[model samples]
Each structure stands twice: as structure tokens, then as C-alpha cells.
Target: MAELRGTNPYHIKPPEPKVLPKNYTQGVDNLSSEDFLKIYIETLRYQDPFQPQDLSKMLEDMTRLNQIRYMNDMKSFMEGLKGWFNQITLLSSLSLIDKEFVFSTNKIDTLKGGQYYLLSSEDIKGATIRIMDGDDVIKEYQVDINKGLNPIELSDLPKGHYSVQILKNGMPVDSLNLGVMGKIKSVSVSGGELLFELENGELVSPSRLIYAGGM
Candidate 1:
């Protein structure tokens, strides 16, 4: 208005478009393959006649659905195989526990003679006892043991180092090697049972002993 020549006006910039995160839809699993196919077909039928959905985009969506189906099937098979392997391992461990076995010692103190007691569970049947002198049989005794705890006496045997063997029905059950002659130090209880402590500081259970003599 005041005779200004070519006055320029201020320009306004448009705001930027908002970017949304992917996977905005929920409840995708509720739709099955058949439902998806029906929806796609109907969209093609009723979509704007001039401006329709791109064929390439529709093909990509179908490919993604097939991949999801394959992944779900694979996951189910792997879960079943894991359960089977766990059962097999549990059965193997139980088999080892049910087998009968013996306990023995290696340290022989070169004792001439001593008294010892054998302890065993009441259910142990057909019990037999034997004394061995370095692969040579010294004496063998038949024992009639009742349930709970039974004691056997092995006296009058000259011993340097002897191995005691317990058998059931002619099969070897358990064995232990006695050290040199020593006196009883004390008796103690472990796991609710009595153990004989020898003067040599060796602790033995009555179950580990097959014979007790000259006490």
C-alpha cells in the first residue's frame, strides 16, 4: 500500500506423515486359511473397479501364510520328541538302583587277627559266608540269617590279611578285605546304624563285616 515493489509473503511448511509400527492388527490366529482365502476373493470382487489391489502384494501375503503353517507343524513334532527322550532316561536310572552289589576295602593293615560283625537287611536271603587268604580258600560257613540284623562268628582262623565274601544262592553278593590285627576303638552310629571303629582309625559297618570272632 505504501508503494512497495514486489513484496514477498511468508511460506508455511506441511507437517510430516506419521509412521506406525508393523503388526498393528490383533487376533490374527483367530482367522483360518479358508477365511483368508474368502476375504481375498471378496476384496477382488468388490474393490474399486478402476483402482484394484496389486497382484504382487496379494501373492506375497499368501506366501507368508504358508510359511507360518509349516513352522507350527515343526514345533509340535519337536515337543513330542523331547517328552519321549525324558521317559527313556528315567527308566535307565531306575534299573541301576535295583541291582544287588557288594562293598569292599583295599587298605590291609597286616593285622594277625580281630573280631568283626556282618550286618545285612532282613530281606537278604540264602546268605553264605566265606573267608579267603589271597586267592586261597581258608574257610566257608553257611549262615541262617533272619530279617533285620544277623551275626556270624569266625574264630580259630590264622589270618594275616583275609577277604570276607558274602554269597546268596551260590552267587557272590558282597566282600571286604580286613587290615592288620587291631583292637576296637569305639562304636558309632551313621545313617541310623552302628559302625565299628578299629584302633587303626578305620570305620566299618556291620553290613560290611561277614564274620566276628575272638571278641
Candidate 2:
């Protein structure tokens, strides 16, 4: 057994008592303007008269709090308005389902070849319509065009995707453009984007569409 030595009172100092900060406004983070005003009034009533609270600083804080609340309210209102607009857009898009819509493109896909149209600004005689399969030209037609829509028969071509081009005197025509017509099967939203499904099982954006109406 070891002999016990007497402890020095000065060496073993007692620990000081813990002092916690008194947070009077604790848990008031979500307080409304009215609630804050009530607290402010109560504080003024209970404060010691000799040691007055800082009136200017308190008023400034109150003004700042009001501004913050106003901004938060405006943010919520704007968000709700945006949601309403999106819902309206979706509702309008739903009307396009089962309707025919035409989109502008130079490409076409067909299971069995179908009829397509070419629009010319002026009368173009002996303009060449070239149907391309990759870099290879599968078919070519020398045809005369009117100033309006000219019907082209693609029923003779094979079933696949092809690029269509109109050329005049071996130079590409500028005024001529191609439009592909399809029926809308459905409309949907994905990742906040609007999408339209076609009868051919293809998904397209509404911005690409130039025309939508009954078949």
C-alpha cells in the first residue's frame, strides 16, 4: 500500500461555474411581423427606465425584418404564378393529342414510303430533288415546281430514314424547305421539359412544330 500525501488547497483549484449566454430571442427565427412587434412592445414595457434600450437600432432592425418578410412573400407569390403558367401550358398542349402537327426538318423516316411536300417561292423548272441515303444518292428526280406546295411521291423508295434536298442548276435552292407531317399520340413532361410523342413513336419538341390542326 502506498502512503497518501496531503493535497495542497491552492494547487487543486475548484472549477468555475459554467456561464451560458442568455438568448432572449431564442427560437424566434420564424416569427412574423406582428409577433415581432408584440415582443418589441413587451420588451419596451419591461426594460429598466434608467438604462433605456437603443430606440434607433431597434427601429432599424424592425425595418430590416419587414423588408425580409416582404421579399419572402413576393418570392412565394412568383413561384406560385410560375406553377400556374406551367399548368396552363400543359393543359393547352394536351389539346394537341390525336391532332395532326407539321414540323420543319430536312429528314424523313418511313416504314412504308409516304407522300411529302415541297414548298417553292417561285416557279422552278427542272429543279432536281435528291433523296440521300448517307453520302450516297439513292434516287433523283428532275421536276418542275409551282410557287406553292408541290407534292412528291416517295412511295417508290425503300423503308428507312433519308435526307431530302432540292437543287437548281446543281446549286442548292435557298427558298425551298421541307415539312414532315405526323399525328400527335401523346404529350408529356420530363425534367421540366415538354415533349410530344408522335404516331411513329418519335419524341419531338413543340418549338419545332410549325402547324397543328385536325387531320
Candidate 3:
């Protein structure tokens, strides 16, 4: 048999060693603490005898490096914690599905009709219930008010989202309190905020909900 002159295809070649310049320590953002220490040692070995490196500054740099590492580790831990919290929130909210909850809100989204209430401090005459679609008032109802919780009844308007405002004497009531009751259809998250989709089409935040109970 002829002597094997060609290189063997199955033979694996060793990777080349990485070489750094003498006393190299320029870019170190990606370097680990051990790698940085090795570079620091090399820097000290090749440092000029007439103009030695500043000991205090070197110590400060090492301290800063360790601090950066610590901060990075903390950031990773926080990210994991946030993920865990979101999962918990999602799991917890699933239990509220099909359960009735009384939440506070000023908006109504429904196909047929909607139910809401106004928490009035005092009875006032000639108050207007202004249903707003964007900036325009789509519907209005003139009615007298009563102290405590006053029920608001809305007819089946077109299927859409609308904002409800109580106006007294043509000015918006600044201290208006509006609330609604609906069964939870679904639960979701948006921008890290927990949200509940009501059976009547309202999207409410958990922070806004004041009461929860069965239908």
C-alpha cells in the first residue's frame, strides 16, 4: 500500500490560541473578571519602571469591574423575577374567569346594553350623561341625580367602545365616580399590567376593580 501522503479528512485540527499584545488592556467590556486579572497582570509586568502604573487607580478600576459584574448579575436576577411574577399573575387571574366582578371604570363596551353606576356626593338638578366617542359626544341623557350610588342605564347603542362622562351645567364633573359590574370573560396582560376582559366587552385593570363575587 502507498504511504498516506494526503491529509486525513477525519482528523480534527486544534484551534489556534488567542494572542494579546504585551500589556494589552483596551477593550474589556466583554472580558470576565479572571480574563481582566490576567490582562492586568500582563500590564503590570510590561509597565515602564520609570513611570509605573498608579496603584490606587488600578485598584479603583478593579473595584469598578467587580461592581459592574455584580450589577449584571443583579439585572439577570431581576429579569428572572419579573418573568416569574408575570406567570403567577396569569395563573392567578385564570381563576376569575366566568366569575362576576364589580370594577370601577368610566368606559362602556357592549353589543346590546351596559350597566353602570355613579357615586354622587350630593343630588344635583339637570345633570347630563354624556356618552363620548373620542372627543365628540355621541349620546346624551338629561336626568336628575341622587345622593349615594345612582344607577345608569344605557340603551343598546352601536357596538363600539365609548367613554361616559357626567356633566353638570355643561361642565364635566371633576369628582365623577363611575363603576360597573360584569363577569370576567378573559384575563390578559398588557405592558406588564394585568387586565380583565369583561363579558360585556369592557377591559379593566385589576387596580380599578373594587369588588369581586359570583354572578
Write one digit per residue (lDDT tens) for candidate 2, span 35-54: 87897899899989999888
**CA error at residue 92 for candidate 3, angstroms:** 3.3
Q: Mind giving the per-residue lDDT tens digits that candidate 3 earns over 1-215?
A: 97777433334333333355676554354577898678778978999989988867876776688677767776776666665566677776787899876678757766435577776778878999988899997888898887666777677567788888888888888666777777889998787778889886768888887654332
Better of 2 and 3 by TM-score: 2
lDDT of 1 at 46: 86
Instruction: Point out the higher-scoring one by TM-score: 1 or 3.
Output: 3
Q: Which stretches of candidate 1 lie over 4 Å from their true place?
A: 1-112, 175-215
Q: Write the per-residue lDDT of candidate 1 for residues 18-111, one digit (tens) a residue.
A: 3334843332444677987898899889889889878677656766875676576666655554544434443333432322222234422236
Give the clashing pairs for model 2.
Answer: none
Q: Residue 205, candidate 2: how far off, in angstroms?
A: 1.9
All models: lDDT?
A: 0.53, 0.73, 0.73
Q: By TM-score, who's the top model here?
A: 2
TM-score of each: 0.32, 0.58, 0.57
RMSD of each: 25.2, 22.1, 15.5
**Which runs of model 3 end up more than 4 angstroms from their true locations?**
1-44, 108-112, 121-149, 156-172, 189-191, 200-203, 211-215
**Can you list the residue pairs that collide in candidate 1?**
109-179, 109-180, 110-180, 111-180, 111-181, 118-209, 119-206, 119-207, 122-147, 122-148
